[model samples]
Structure formats: C-alpha cells, structure tokens
Target: MSEKKFQTVQLTLEQSVESRTKLIQGAINRAAHTAGVVSLAGKGVYVIDGLLMKSGVTLDVQAGVTLMGSGNEDKYHHRPGPFELLRNQTPICALIFGNQCDNCVISGKGTISGNYRCFIKANQEQAAHIESHHYPRPEMIYLQDSRNVTVEGLTIIDSPFWTIHLAGCQQVKLANLTINNEVRMPNTDGIDLDRCQYVVVQGCKISTGDDGICLKCTEETKRFGDCTDIEVTDCQIHSQSAAFKVGSSSFGNFLSVKVVRLLIVNSNRGLAFQLRDGGLARNFQFSDVKISTRDFSEEWWGNAEPIYITFVARDHETVIKPDDGIENVQFSNINANSPTGALIYSDVAGRIKNIRFVQTQLWITTEVGKMRHYDLRPSEKRQSLIMPVSGLVGRVKQNQQAGLSVMYRSNEDQPD
Candidate 1:
C-alpha cells in the first residue's frame, strides 16, 4: 500500500483573540492526526492564548510571523498545568506548551512575543525588576515529558518569566535560537532544562534577566532519574545573573554536563554551581569560555563573581542524604573581566569535592574595585557577609581537596 501524504497547512492570522486561538488550535489538531506540518505565515501578529503541540506535529513559524500573547488571564485557562519550578504562584500560563509528545519540532525565523511589560507592575523605578505580586506571569514556552523534540531558529523576546523551559524530556535538540528579554525582568532565564536527558543546545544567543542557560533539578520533579548527557556550546550569553548556572534549584543529581566556548557578553555573574537543595553533580566540564561580569543591582542573585560554587543546604530543616555532594567538576581556559573572583564554599566541610581550574585568567577591573561583601543567596537567612576581595576563596577540609592551576590575576597595581 502507498503511504498517505503528509498534510501541509498554512495559516494567515488577523482576527479576534478568540478566533485566532480557535483557528490555530483547529489547524494543529487536524495536522497532528496526520503527522503533518502547520505553518504560521504572513506578517500580521497572531494573538494566542497558547499553542498546544502534540505528537507527530511540526509548527513552523515563518519569517516575519509574530505570535503574541493575549495578555488576558482567562484566555490562558487552557494550559496543561504549572511546571512548579517557578517561584511565582500567581498564575501559570504559557504561549507554547507540549506535554507527553514525541516527534515534534518548533522552528523558523519568526518571533514569539511574551508581551511581558503587561505583567510588570507600574510606577516602579528600581534597578532590578519587581514583577506583579498578584498577576499571572506566564512563561514564553514550556515542554515536558516529551521525547525527540527539536527547536531551532526562533527569536523569543520580552518574556515575563523563563523564556524556554524543558522538563523531564529526552533526546531534545535546541540550536540557533535567540532570546533577548528586558535586562531587568526577574527570573526570565533564557533556557532552563529540568530533569532532562540527552539534550544539545548550540549556536544560540541569549540575554535575559537571569541565567542565560541553566540546568536544574526541581523538588517537584525529583522522581526522574539523573539529568545526564547534556551539552551546551558555541553560545553568546548575557544576563543580570549568571551567564551559565546549574541549579540554585537542583533536587536531582546531574551527570555528564559539558558547556564550552560560551561568550558571556556582560553578566552579573559568570559560572555557578548552586546546590542549595543537596543534589549532587559530577562529570561536569566547562572550557574555552570568555566572560564579563559587573555588579548591577541588589535585586539580582549574584555579585559579579566570575566563578561561584556552593554546595550547601537551604536551612536546618532541609534534608540531605549522607552522600549528597558535588564533585569532579572542572573549568579550563576560562577568561573573565570582573571585579570579584571565584568563591568555593559549602555549609559544611567536604560536600564540594574535586573542583579544579586550569589556565584561568581573571582581570579584576578597578571599575567596581574592592567589593567588600560575599553573597550566599537562595539560602536560609544568611544573605551576605562582609568580606574582602581576593582572587580566589574557598572552604576546604583537611582530607578532601580542591585544586587550582595557572591562574593569572591582573589589576593596575599588580602588574605581574
């Protein structure tokens, strides 16, 4: 028997919010049944509550097409549910969401606008952003419990929260995507992979209010196995927080993480391993990264540390397995222009092991000279301490060790 042809449908959107939502939903639902493709074409802005992607479906947002959020809370009641990693509990919404789907792709050189300014509170001039405490702040894109997914070549902008969050997925590939949010929007991480496996992110440029590319193991999704075999490379990242961070939200062990050749444009912090939840990580490697960091505002999470590693429990009430720790992490050929240096600390001794740096150069600029405070945020009660600037600081036990090799510190006074 001959194979049935794949259905290919193209849509032009310029209608009421309700009409456009139904049109796109109908097109996707029909196309998904036939393993087909649905393209959102034309120059008009498409107002959507959400786009539900199913298995065997491809959403090709063509160039010049714009998918804009409706900015109405009631239109978004159709979302599957919250991912629950978000700190905000006001309302859970997403512009594009897929759950339990396989063989799906979202690509093209179009734009997805979150319309984030609508969610920001008015009449506030703080350097850091304060989101609306009472309104729904939806993510731009969220996919969970899916396999064989691919996203590429899209420009995602102005997100009120995390730009793209993939959770509990397998065999995902993200490439050549761009995320540029308002630099002060809170928690608008460019890409967050949670409890995911075999993911590759490459050739992307991200700038946001939080970590540019982050991996986490959330408390709600700890039932999944270790996050393993993830790679991020050839990306340019800038953020008010760390350019690349692994978990201030970790609740599961992470394994085989490789991040390389990232150009951090300007960040508040550069590289960090924040294991406040006691989840261990191993076999993580970072290399050939160039970073620029500066202290921006007190509302953010970091204080310009080029590399910060802390493996500490949140509080006395936090539970930690006896063997829960981070180890076998390495950073090589790192170059940074920042005010502060590396901070290696733990709540107790010997929790962080085998941390190493090779051929790292930190040019401590005099722009923000002599920062006298240390930050241990996302922790319990202990926010910061009055400390002096040093090239490197750490907490090491007598038996266990962390190593440093060929580190160069440069400033005006210290010529050598």
Candidate 2:
C-alpha cells in the first residue's frame, strides 16, 4: 500500500477539557494519523484512514459524540469519491470484535462511511453481471467473532459489500441502525450472518440489490454447525432479490429462525427460503409481511420465483448424504401485490410439512392465468393436493365467513 502524506496536529482533551468541537475533532484526526491507528484518548470527532490494531481495541464513544467517516460525493451523487475511504487497507472492517474479545459495544449517533466494495459488490453481483477484475475491493464492515456485542443508533453507509457480516458469533443485538445502500451500484447486501446464533435484527431500514437480510449456514461439508435462534422484527426491506432469504448455503442445519412485521417492496422475490439438503431446516416462521413486486413474470428472468421453498439435492460426485429437509414451516398474514403474482413450489425430492398461509391476500393487480393459485375456492370443491408423498393430505376450503382453512391429516399416519 502506498503511504499518503498527512500534516499532523495534536491536542490533549484531558488537559484542554473545554475545547471546542472543531478543535477536538481536528486533534483526533491528527492523533489517528500520527499513530497509524485511530486512538483518540477521550470523546471527540475523528477522521483518519488505515486504522490497524495490534492488540484488541474498544472504541467507546459517549452518547452525544459522533465517529464519522471521511467522505465527499461526486458532483452527481451517483458515484462516491475518496473522501469516504475509512481505511486504506483491504480487510476494512469497522469494529473487529476479534475472537478473544467479549462484551464490546459500538454505540452513539456515530456516522461510519466508506466506499465498501463488499457492500457494493454483493448488491452489484445480484443486479447485473460483474467482470473478473473487481473481486478484490473491500466488502464488509463490523466483522464480529466475539460474544455479547451490541450495535445501536449508528448510520453506516456506502459499504462496498455487506454492511454487517457476522460469522460464527453469538449473543449479538443489532437495533436502531440506519443502513442505506439503495443506489444499486454493485454488491450491497444489508446484513448477512453466516453460521451465527442468537442474533436479533430489529428496527432497521435496508434497501439493496441482493437479499436485505441473509442468514446462512455452512457453505460446504467442511464446515459443520447449525445456525439457530435468530429473530428479525419491525423492519422495512427492499431488494432486487428476495427481501429475506435463508440458505443458498445450508450445508449446516438452520433451525429456529423467526421473522415478523416486515414491509418489503419492489423485490423480484419477496420471501424465499431455500434448503440445500446439506442439513435440516426446521421450525421457521415468516409472518405479518407486506410484499409488493414490480413484475413477477419470468419474462425478465426465467429463474426468478417469488415465495420459493426448495431442497436442492446433493451432487453425485460429493457423495454427501442428503442431510437437509424443511419441516414445520409457516407463512401467515402475508399480503402481496404482484403483476404475475406468487408461486409456491417445492422440489420433487424435498420433504415439507405444515406450510400454512393464514389470511394471505395475494392481489393479482392484472388479470393473468399464472396467478390462479392465489384465488379462493369453495369448501366442497376442495381436493387433496398431492405431490410425491401420495397420502399427504391438505384440504384448502374457503368460505365467505372464515376466509380459508387448510386442514391435513395428523403426521402419525400416511395411508398405503
């Protein structure tokens, strides 16, 4: 990395206790420059780049202080310029709560901005095809591998990749964070937690080109563990792909994921849960979600399916036993407005149970044949919907009073 020349200046806040905000913020910038790291002793404003910590560090900003990223936008605001580069290094994560460090907190109304390629790249890869040369740009922020971390009331933007990526971490609480990557530049996923547990994503607004919130398990057989006890609530999400998705990478089991009270719009697929037969995915719920799609027809992309659930089979060469299947999944109070409407499909080889849609109002804004599935029917005309497992029984009978009641036989018996 080439070293950029910086004119340094310093002021000690403990001595100059009543220093003006301008003096304090300037001193922080100088101190961070001189030390080759961001180490401002007391509460103040700071803007410097390439902050590397030799040992673990804790950045505790007081309630009213702000930790801002150095950035200025191009004249059009369509592209971001260098004034936003937080760190000159490649693996540029804001708060690296390293493995051995616990009980770390990044709080206050601090604004962290950088041209995060990881943030921009993930979103870009989804919206359009990217070339081979753009692979090495910075992509992630706030990588946590520790326990008991809390991030609240922060504005993090212009990330090159996913805003916050947590891998194999536990007891994380993320609340009241405003993360916007709505420009649709490249690969900007809002939040992705790979193989993490006890994670809570609540009260956040995420707009991107890819999945707004993605919870992933193991990518392959080499990594073995489950992602469990994740809850997301009271959030607004928009994307080019599924607003919320789980498992294009379910090599590890994903259990106990719950989502509620979400408002999602302008997505190709509103909510998609995919299981890759690598491990078991069970006990999941997607409830009270309001979804709107611009177009649902495959005329744009033949592979896009809204509200999809599938279990991808194992590749023959790997000889990995099919360890994943979805069970006990529920979708309730889902209201959708789509041009081509939604599709509910599961692969022939997958196993699913208790897929219920309670009070689902699927509005086909245009009269089209493919959306016939969302229309209601009478009670006596209902039939047993059968796929692979023959005796599998579900009777969807709609009435003017009760709306829809889909009843199935108890799991104890499957007829010969």
Candidate 3:
C-alpha cells in the first residue's frame, strides 16, 4: 500500500522553535511536509517527535497555539510543558497529529490541553483491601486512518482522553467544535466517532463524562457493514450518557442515523437509540429535541425517558441468537418533558417500523406508563410485550384504514 505523497507545512506564532529545529528536521525528512502549522505564543511543549511521527502529517494551528500538557504546575491546574517536563525523555509515544493523512486539515483557533486524568480508575475488589483511583483519560484527540478530514475551529480543553477520536476515517467533518470535561470526569467521551465514514457533526458544544456525541461501530472489529451516512446537526449535547447514542456496540450495522437541530439539556438519558446487545438498526431519526429536568431525584439507572429505544440480545463475541435484533427505526419531531412514564422501549425480536409520534408533544410530569414493544411469536417461542403495531406486524393485518384506531393489547392483562 504505497502510492500517496503530498505535503504542506506552516508554523506561526513567530517561528524560531529554537532556530527552526534543523529546518523542522528537514521538512519532516523527505516526506516533504505537505502541511503543518503551529502558531506558538506560549507556555511551550510543541514537541512533535520521530520521522516527524510518520503518516503524511498535515497539521494547522494558527490563532494562538497553546499545546501544553502533563498537568500540575502547582495548581489552578494545566501545566507540564517543555515536551512533558523532560529529563532524557523520549516519551513521544505516537503523537502523529494526523495519521494515514489524505486531504488532512487540522484547523486553527487552537488548544490541545492534556495532563492525564480526565479520568480512569481500575484495580477492583471491594470486599477487602483492593482499591484505586485516578480517572480522566478522555484526552484522546486521535484521528486515525484519516481521509477528507476537517476538525474545525478547535478549543479542546483539559482532556485527560476523549475530546475527539475519529478512528478508521472517511470523509470526516467535525465543525465548530468545543469539547470540555469536569462534570465528575471519568472516561470523558465528548466526541467519539469511531470506525468512521461519511460523517458530519456540526456546531458542537459538548459536556462530558460519557456519551455526548458517540457513533461507534463495533462487533469486535470484524468490520461488519453499515455505519452509514451520519448527520448530527446544530449540536449542544451535554451528557452523562445518551445525549445521543446508537448501539452499545452493535456488531456493526448501526445504519443511516440522522439527528437534526438538537439542543439537548441536562442529559442523563434524553434522546437515545440503543440496541441492547446486538445491532441491525436502520434509517434512525430524531428531530428537534429539547429536554430539561436535570434531577428530580428518580434515576434508578436513570429513566427520564425523553425517548428511549432498546434492543437487547447480548454477545458480539458469541451468544447472541434471536437473530441479533433491531431493524428499521424512526422517531420524528421529538419534544420532551418527562417525569417518567415509560416514554419508549423496544425490547427487540425484529420489525420496529415507522415508530413515529409526529408533531410530538410530551410533558407527562409522571405516570404515562407502559409503551413496550418486544415482539417474537411464530412458535419461535415466547418474547412478547405488545402495544406496537401501527402497521407491519404480520405485513399489514391492521391499521385497516385506522379502524377502532387499531387495537391489540396484552402483556398479561388479557380479556380481549
């Protein structure tokens, strides 16, 4: 795989990074530096090491570069410059600004702060001695296998791991980005677009601990199809989890997701499309969402339920056989104000068609319970929750011109 050669380099904030470090180490030693810019006016640590850290490398940082991280220079946080407080150090562990670089573009208006501990704490056993704490590794601004990339207007702050991680890329575009952590920080995932493809996340503003804006493609990396045509528009996803999510890692196949004009508020679980264990989601949509009610106590695993869609089969590494559930989903014109009345939950045995609540209006301050749809009854044996069949339960048996407005209710109350 060798036939890609194009480079550009530019570094501002008044040059002279110690007399241009051997002319920036000879235009990154023959790869010929296609594009590089780091406007220094700073507290230092612009130590981009190795064959200038291979893979094409096209970095652009103009408007005031303050790339310093290693934390703790007394307090008030943020410190550790001089290439991470050196003393015969070479800890430049794969800091390749842009890897597999195609049409790379890491825009100006800079800031890539790090110092370890956005959050990570492991070493369990809460029965006796064993215990540990550190948290905050959400400092991963990695854009892997890059393609037509564009990480615009950056202001990435105190990421101890996930500010922006676009793994296995293709035609990526994360616009007007601004990711931050410190809401009880632990594995702070602000913007994680893993196993990427034609992505477009616009006008971002994320608050994190987990799941601010996540669209993952996983099934243990066999690379199963469909992370298709994504579009997350006009964003502001403040999260604790599910400001927006699809698949807990759907053996791949998290298809055609579209979230338009969102302004998610105080999220614990606002607008979610989660596939319980397996994945085969299709043409998903969530439009015009706005939710608030940070905490009115009740969050037993949190159920503010603005609109939750779940499909559980479990096992991406083997054990999922109910035909790895979830298929063709739709949620339009969303509006929320829930106090919890089971807004939505699809347990999954298949066929979750056109799930709409058009021109939606929900302000159920408590008690609107039961809207479960689990399906699976063809002598395939047990798995039914009923109450969903606007159409396509046995291929259009009812909706019969909306007669009796369509009826079928039975979870075990029977009597019909």
Candidate 4:
C-alpha cells in the first residue's frame, strides 16, 4: 500500500459569480502550499465561499465537478481571523474546512452542493434579526482537530447542516458516501461523529432529515475523550430521526461499537441507544439488522420503534451525571417490522445491563395501528429481564402464537 506522489494542481474557472469565490480560494491556496493534488476538473460551477484544507492536501474532486455553495450567509459567516475563539460554537459556516490536519483527503466522483434552499432562506432571514442561536446555515464537510482523515467517493447533496462533521477526529475513514438530504431538511445529519477515534463507516448511502448516522459527546464535545473504536458496515439508512444514534448529547463514553450489515428503511427510529447527559453506552454489537419503521410527526423523535433503548434523567430536576447507563448490549440477526414494539428504559438511577436478543424476528403489525405496551418509560421506575427465546418470533393477532406476551409489574402493584 504505497502509491503516494502527488503534485497536481489544476483549477481555473472564474466566469465571474463574483470571480468564483476568488478563483476557488486561490486554487485552494495553491494546492495547500504545494503538498499538491487539488484537482477540480471540467463541467464547472465551482463557487466556494469557504475552504481551508492544509496538511498533506488532496481535495481531488473530479468527474464533472460541481462544488457549489456561495449561498452567501455573509460569505459563509466570516470569522477566521484569530481563529475566532477556536471556532466559537460553530454555528453553520463550513464548506470544506479541515483543521488540525494530518494526512487529509476528500476524494471524488464529484458533487458537493449544499445550496440548501439558499441556506434555508438565509436562516429564515437571520432569525428575525439575530438570536435563535445565531442562525447561520453552512456545513457540507467540516472536519476538525483532524488525524488521518479520508472521505471517499462523494455525492453529497443539499445539506444546510451536519452533512459530514467529524470533530476531534483520529484515524477516520468514511467510504462510499452518497448522502442525499432534504426529506424536509432540518439539521440535515447524514454523518456526524464527534469526539471520534478509530472510525470507519463503510459503503454508506444515507437518506436523512436528521440522524442517519450520529455519535456524539456534547456540551460542544467535552475535550475529545471517549467515542472509541467505531465501525458501521454496509449501511443504507433512511431517517426522520434515529436510523442509528447514540445520544441526546451524551457527555462522553461509547466504547468498542459495531453495527453490521444494516438496512433501515422508512425510519422514524431503529437502534437508538440514548443515555441522556452523562453517557456510558457500553460494548455494543448489533448484527445483520433489517428494520422498517413508520409513524412520524410528534414533531419527530421517533415512536415507530424497531429498537429504542434509553436511560433517562436529562432532568428530573437535574444531577444525574457520572456514566448514566446502558451496558454490554447485543442484538443478533434481527429482522424487525415495526408498529412500535421495542423499547427498554432505565432510570431509577440507571441500570439496563447485559441485554441480549439472538436470532430475532419481530413483526408487530396492526397494519400501523395497535401499539400496546412496550414503550417502556418511567412507568414507576424501570428494571428489565425479558430473556427466554430460542429464536423468538412474533406476528400477533389471530390465534396468536408467534409468542412474546409477558407483563410483570410488582412493587406491590401486583401482577407478576
């Protein structure tokens, strides 16, 4: 694996859309000061108001290059002077800006158009004169605190937010991405791995409004600690939310993860392991999954569950911090057809441990109706134990024996 010798620089197309953003930022600062290979060939529309690549540069976007996004939110929120307080709360502003770079690369098969409805009408007219979190729409690739990053074969479309944001990265590699946003686009997340480490998202074809692939540790990323050894393989996810998620900004700690062979279609929720605020979603492994969830609009957070594990206490009057919950999980060979049937909650000071589901095949259908129980919540402090299956199968209604009907509730509220 040794074929590295680039010094190619070929960019020149200024037919004046304001001089094509200063001739593509001076041909990417003359191919990032000669570490070269900044080729953006033919069929031009190249108008970038932002681009800051540097370390061992290689922004080779060829195959009839499009790279357009000069949807002027004050020229992509201008503020890179004194590093602007080290990217002060990155509200929008990013059309390919990799910082703290190592062996960087943004490969091709061109098209990076994040002209998302003119930046969502310029963030709704700058949110009626500022302060709706200072609305400034712009992100079509913002890799931060980088290490050996590589974004392969791109076809990234209309993203007004989180299209590919890898923060505090380390040895990352995102392959075959074809993110197509605007399914009612709001927070357009297709790939967002924050506080990253040893990452790899393979053969991706994400469809999103939000959270098609997300793993975060926020409070604006707590100094890049634990979002350890990740791996997502052969994905084809669709989401309004949760086609694959980790938290609701879980502070940090999601070690040794693995999601294999996924195909989640028409999603509202499928495999969301959320431990709000303080996070420790331990040793997860979800294999060969195929989920098809429905039901949307409670303003979208997901109820058409194919699996939604939660360990709450984001605020039962605050103070539930250190490593909240969700442990040693495993779900093997699942094939779910949802009408809302899988949820496991834990919030009496968190404890949802050693959960396992093997050779599973669930089909809970009322043809999109009947959702009885199984949306576990703080229904009087939770604790779980639903393990007894030799290849569990369920498809309720009519002579019912596809199995799985257990209900136990006893804290003296008797019904064991």
TM-score for all models, in order of appearance: 0.91, 0.65, 0.32, 0.34
For model 2 the local lDDT of residue 167 reads: 67
lDDT of 3 by residue, 1-416 (tens): 34434443454445544434334446544442434433323434453221132344444454556554433322121212222112322211212234566666556676665544412345332322111143222234665566787878877765555567666688888888787765455455777676577899999888765678877665433342457788999988777656777656555666677888888776666766565445566667777766642332221124445555555443333245554544455555655554432223444433344454455555444323444332221112233444432312222111122111212333243221
What is the alpha-carbon lDDT for the whole of candidate 3? 0.52
CA lDDT, every prediction? Answer: 0.80, 0.52, 0.52, 0.70
* Top TM-score hit: 1
Candidate 1 lDDT over 42-134, as tens digits, reads 776777787788887888888988888877756663443334443433336677888887989899899999988778778767646666655
lDDT of 4 by residue, 103-186 (tens): 878898988888777644334542311112234366788877889989999898878778898878999999998999876666
Off by over 4 Å in 2: 1-97, 116-132, 142-144, 220-224, 296-306, 313-323, 370-416
Ranking under TM-score, best-scoring first? 1, 2, 4, 3
TM-score of 4: 0.34
- Range of the 10 consecutive residues with the lowest summed lDDT in candidate 2: 74-83
Residue 253 shift from truth in candidate 4, angstroms? 6.8
lDDT, candidate 4, at 164: 92
Q: In model 1, how large is the Cα lDDT of residue 8?
A: 38
Q: After superposition, how far is residue 202 of candidate 1 from its true place, in Å?
A: 0.3
